[model samples]
Target: MRVAYYCQHVLGMGHFFRSLEIAKALADHEVDLISGGPEVRAELPPHVSLFRLPGLMMNDDFSELYPLEPGRSLEEVKNERARLLSERFLLFSPDLFLVELFPFGRNQFSFELLPLLQDIRDGHFGPVKVVCSLRDILVEKSNQEKYEARVVKRLNEFFNLLAVHADPALLRLDETFGSLDRVRIPVRYTGFVTTKPRSGAGIALRRELGLEPSQKLIVASIGGGKVGGRLLFAALQAFARLGLSGARMHVFSGPYMEASEFLALEKLASAIPGVILEHFTDRFLDYLDAADLSLSQAGYNTAMNILATGVPALVWPFDQNHEQRLRAEKLKQLGVLGILEDADLESERLAVRMAQAMEAGRRSGPAPVDLDGAANTARLLQDLAS
Candidate 1:
């Protein structure tokens, strides 16, 4: 079974990371991972080949963007590199082609995927099951319900299936899809996808994070390498706001961050006692396991890991983006978390909310969110392969 996964991120590693995780589960099958976003550090298992595209990613405030090279002309780039990469990517001839998020977001790069999806749909390519992978929420700017309806409906028609990685009961903030519950295509609530508890490495990670016998640590991480800079800043602010002098703040600024940016954050961490701001680490889930509370932006990856850890968190979904705000509200309503919006972000408020979130997090435990997602997703692809 050969599966071709297409994920492009301009700023962060959420989509690519999720696809890589899913790809690992299908290690027995041949895999081709393709990207157009700026380069990121991705470790793929055997049988997984990677394809890089034309542009190099630049980290702007919102997310990653691929600007044309310093000397290369845009026209030349389009005439040469883009054309070649697109042709090369098609050579894979995958049995199952998965489109991550573009059906709903990222219309600009539609050219990279449109030809492929069209070919598969038209039988130009061999029989392929095309699926659209959706994170729990489609972050939007405002209540652009009218514009969103068009996109969601088009996405529904464009693919054979919709795989939502979030448990809606935990956060049914999918205004776009929630209304289409009666649609014919299967809306598989595949649950949250997360890195499993690796036996050998997890213990060391916990120890390194300074989890005492029962310190009740709270780990706050933004998603991979982009878009969560403000969230990390907010976390630092939250620590100071909440006056968490005793609690350990393990802030993971993804490794892809600029040296100057990271050093600046490091300075902030130094001034604040009990704050350990560092670069990316492998023990994401383990830190969650050892944590008493978690703080982060509402990216699907971080949310899934938090759920997997079965600990509590104070999640402040991104404010500028409407998608995360809705997601944060949904998860909060499900009793899986507590939230502070970007509008409500401040040091004092964050400190108070962090305390409340910690208290709220401990009340009962992780409410039922999807945990069997990775296996279920793997099964879906395996069946498609067959």
Candidate 2:
């Protein structure tokens, strides 16, 4: 079966990577992956092909839309993207057309997505199975009820399935999108989509990085580096206060952090004996596996990685959107992670949590949450195709 997977990641790399994981899981079949965002380096499996469209990114607060290209008009770019998307939908003629986030999120790309859906509804792409590949939690809108009503209208008209990459035991759709019953389509829980580490990858990486046995390893990161400066900044202060504690810190400030902030972190790390700072690494999960503890933002991909590794973690959820807050709360309730409040991001408060996390040591044993989402998503796609 041929599948066309569309994903647009505006702020972070989470959506792109999650979509990639599902595409990899369906590696037994032909997959055409469509990405409509700024370029990112990602490893793709043999069965997948990529079709990158003209990119768009939102401002920091998601208040405005802009073209990724310098000095280009947003309308021109949007038109081009819409044209390309329509062309691809017709050419690929996929048995299944999977969209990462729509109606629920990525409403910015409605110019293209709505048209694509119309084509499917009009049978331009005959008998194609349309699905929404959504993350576990959704961001609550300002006017949620009206927003959901519009979403329900779209889903009932165009979508055949809703593939939620979450375990119902942990969180259900209704918890976030309260109008769940109005979706009017089949919803399938595909476990918690996460990539499992390779056997002995942690041990191998430790040896490669020359980490000593007696030294405690701490991995700190901010996904995509768009808005994690506060958390990353606080961590630096916390680590500095706990100096010479035999703990080696590795910090990934994220790829999109401002130059000023990243430079500050670099200078700070240079003065610190055991702290190493870098911009980004694709081997993020491996680093988490090698760490005694993880300090990071509570994004979907990072949280799932923390859970899969069963590493003791301290997370500061992005309070602006209830998405991260809800996810962090649920995971904290499950005992996999500890929360660091927005009120207490200062060095003194974080140092206390840091010390406590270090003293607790590695969290050994199997993870309590399901990690079979990638595989299960593939199984469902096959079922839908049949």
Candidate 3:
């Protein structure tokens, strides 16, 4: 089977990573992973090929779109991107079209997406099984009724199925999108998509770091780093205040964090002993497995990583929407993790929380929700193609 997976990440890298995991799982199929956001570095499996469109990204607040390259007008980039995307679809002639967060999110790219979808429906790209890949929770729109209606119309008109990458036991699509009954298509819950750490990777990493059994390893990160400066700064300050002897804290500020903010974090981290700072790491899951405590935001990918590793985590949910907070609260109820409040950002308070979380240790037994979303997504797509 041939699959063309379309993913557009405007602000954060969570969407792209999740989509990539699913594509990796589809090793039996020929996959063209189409990405049109800021370039992200990743290692692809032999069966997967990446097709890049002209870069377009959103501002922090998602108020407007801009081209990644300088001196290129937004209109020019959009036109070129649309043309390239259409040409790619016609050339690839994929049996299935896996679109990430279209009607449920990333509506800004409708200038290209709507036209492409319409073309597919008109037989321009041959017989294509159009599917939507969505996350668990959705950000509340200002006009939710209109938003949902538009989504239902589009899904019914163009999409063949809606594959939500979330464990229904943890969260269902209808919980966030209220009008699920109106949509006339199959909607399957494929669990939560995430990459699993290698067997014994944590134990090996801990030994490589030359850490004593008594010493604690704390891992801190902000997904994509575009808006997590405060979380990283707070974590560093709290780690300094904790002053635990021999304990090490490794902080990844994410690749997209502003240079000034990263430089500030670098200076602050330099003043503290046993603290290491890096921009990003491919071994994040392995580090989480080795850590006694994890500190970060409650984004989709990070939450899934924590679940996969069972690391004791303290997460600061993104305040702009209820998506992160909703997921965080659910995990909190399951005793899998703890949530961070505004007041917790204070150095003393956060230090206390960190100590408590580390003392509590890793989660016991298996995770409460399903963690096989990537595999299940591949199976579903293959079955559909068959």
lDDT of all predictions: 0.70, 0.88, 0.93
Per-residue lDDT tens digits for candidate 1, residues 151-210, read 666666567777777665665535644456544567777777777655544447657755
Greater-lDDT candidate between 1 and 3: 3
TM-score of 2: 0.97
Evaluated with lDDT, which candidate comes out highest?
3
Residue-level lDDT for 136 in candidate 2: 91
* Residue 174 accuracy (lDDT) in model 2: 87
Residue 23 displacement (Å), model 3: 0.2
**Candidate 3 structure quality by residue, lDDT tens digits, 311-348:** 99999999998999999999998899999999999999
* lDDT by residue for model 2 (316-382), tens: 9987889898999999898888999976688888888988876777667887777899999999989
Displacement of residue 17 (Cα, Å) in model 1 is: 1.2
- Measure candidate 2: CA RMSD: 1.2
* TM-score of candidate 3 against the unseen true structure: 0.99
lDDT of 2: 0.88
